[model samples]
Target: MDVSGAGGLTDDRVLLGRTSTAERVADILRTRIAEGYFPPGARLSEESIGGALGVSRNTLREAFRLLTHERLLVHELNRGVFVRVLAVGDVDDIYRTRRLVECAVVRGLGQPPFAVDGLAAAVAEGEAAARADDWTGVSTANIHFHRELVALAGSARTDELMRGVLAELRLAFHVVDDPHALHEPYLRRNREILDALRAGERASAERLLARYLDDSRTRVAAAYAQAVDDPAGSAG
Candidate 1:
């Protein structure tokens, strides 16, 4: 696939900086993975990607190795590299982590010294996407919403962790039968949570977020189960 237009890393200028060129390439690929440009199980064509990104074969290999270590990509002996497909357990684990972290963020939101600007902005973006009938855009904006939710904690470590969690969530989202069905209902819920947070209704917001995640977890897990059972019948 042509990733030159996606992944926020389209610049082809020679990579030269403190970090190795391979690491820079890996970052680009990671962004692509998170953005859903390269869906789960999509094969990475070294020649196409390397040439498109203006990188050498050696650098691409190194970048692939990095993503493999991050569990975003896998390498088979003769099959080359493909995006890692999450198992049902992986889906459950991701939600479990989110419940612990995100709910806590909402619980703490009403406390003094917090920022809801990011969260509000994410909601606006999602609403705009929904208005435009862009399911993918809604999905992207939803991911940003949760990422910003975690940022309310003002912890660098937590923000970094959510980045990985959100990326893995994208992998599972690719299997859902109806992106609109799965996401449209939740847009209103997101707005409700934001409103509660703004009103200092911490308890209400936390409850809303818990229910929201539980429903989403069930939906995505069920869809992933169906996809794993019959890949040919799965949705994209």
Candidate 2:
């Protein structure tokens, strides 16, 4: 019996091989952390997680280090790894930077001289994810859309900073109770923002994007406050 056709092997092992143990462990840990399977400040034990992922402690440690550098995990001397929680000031600074970066992207928008098909595709994906009630997918697509939006600024540094901001925002999303409520209404708003850009109304798009950012900040802060007040109620 050929194990190859049974999803066991392939002609190109390089292409069909399973992900590296470290990469797989990192991905699992990242997804769980993002999905709130492990709440902020939850300590992670290498031995237990290695057992769960069928990986060595070394591999799991590598994964932990990766996430720690990404700001998703925190490692302290004499203390093990724990999920990083965003402070109120961190959230405030995140939105302030987002407003500056994203508004600039919108302000630079104009008709068809640049290809925005990628942005359009990301918006479509986000809308579909929202409809499917896949909050994680919705959040991922939302980040992609805005990242592409900021990419229009033609600055690699801006793009890198935006990526970090988006990851921190994902942490905020996990902390909030009603994730859908925070993202659902923005589907139309994103479309409208794109429409304004396509119509060459750069100023209008900038205004709309600024307003959207403000509203999102308000919602996130309210949710964070509620989460703080009632810990058990806000399980992402």
Candidate 3:
């Protein structure tokens, strides 16, 4: 769904009187990237996108700058902008952060002081997506589950950071050969972690989450390695 329109710029005045059009455009483009509509290494056609979205070139460039700062887009001297493809080191760092933050949150919830509703909800979402064979949905719910787990800490700052981390993580997932095979095994693991949290088994939950992050990092790193070793045969 190309969400650009000739009238969207003018309509923005009525929809959000004081909001910056460039910011709105950035949000739209960011969502598109996150949804994998623009795969890793795919060139972003500024002229075409600007025309489609009915925005000036300047506005589109601002949007590109914003995403670039978020590490979602990268610019090369002659190649314009493309969605970032995560390297093995990037994968390692992301998982390291996840383990440090998420495991700490789980460890603190020793007696279930916080509500498990968010965690439970994410688990249910993953389960439903799995039943429907929606691998993308499953992957989304999986990230949501981790996000919700971070929310247990009640820190807005951590939540914001995890959102960016998960978005980058999704880029890695977008390159995997089989979404179903990649994500199917984790649906049950999410449930197990949720159950541990619900049971107030803090140690058990932390252990499970640590293992999950470790496994995911290893799998994604291998996928990236394969892509680099054999670009022609790579899924991305």
Candidate 4:
């Protein structure tokens, strides 16, 4: 997957002209981290990774910095960068914030006249990914669908915060052994919520969304607890 030399570039330059090595490295590493290739509490060694990825230490360091800022990786003084460890409080905070933002969006569902097609498309993508057994893709699509759901409220700040919240929640998904079990059931529920919205059943949609979030929070928390107690049994 290294594209640095694919385009007949001279040793002095990289492919695509403008994409820096650091940026490319960051994207590759981020995708792997999100896909659960790097488990929580796992230590990342710069030199070894650089060698494996065919990059220099400098480029890898820059990539690490990007992930650290995204809160996907944490740097411990002198101990090196490790994937973040999520506590029970992290789970609570993530779900609490999601409920507040998502429910608010639900309450404002029909008042301002919002676009629901984007959410519908995202849900379709999630369904496809689920069918293909691409759990990471399913998680990514699901997050985007819900973010679109929150966008119905018409608040830019809420949108930004919800993205961060979802990113943190994805960490929990990595903790669970079966990503499908955690998210597959919700695909139909999401469709139901959207149906309520399309039918102008605002109150019903709100209620459905609330219950959906509650069930999701419980599943994620239980998975996290199981992972913590039996790390070997959990997914990456």
lDDT of each: 0.82, 0.72, 0.78, 0.74
Cα lDDT, model 1, residue 86: 88
Determine which window of 10 residues in candidate 3 has minimal summed lDDT.
1-10
Better of 1 and 2 by lDDT: 1
Model 3, C-alpha of 141: deviation from truth (Å): 1.4
Residue-level lDDT of model 1, residues 1-236, one tens digit each, is 22324333445334534444897788678767877888888888887787667778999999999888878888989878888888889999999999999998777664743567888999999999999999888999999999888998879888877887888889888876678877898899999988988877788888999999999888878877887888788543
User: Candidate 4, TM-score vs. the true structure?
Assistant: 0.72
Off by over 4 Å in 2: 1-39, 42-70, 109-112, 234-236
Give the per-residue lDDT digits (tens) of candidate 3, residues 1-236: 22223323333334323554887787667656665667788788876677666677988899899888989889889868888888868878888988898888888764564588987898899899889989898888888888889998889888777777778878888877778877888889998988887777888888998999899878778876776667667543
Best by lDDT: 1
How do the predictions measure up, each by TM-score? 0.85, 0.72, 0.80, 0.72
Question: Which prediction has the highest TM-score against the true structure?
Answer: 1
Cα lDDT for residue 226, candidate 3: 77
The better candidate by lDDT, 2 or 3, is: 3
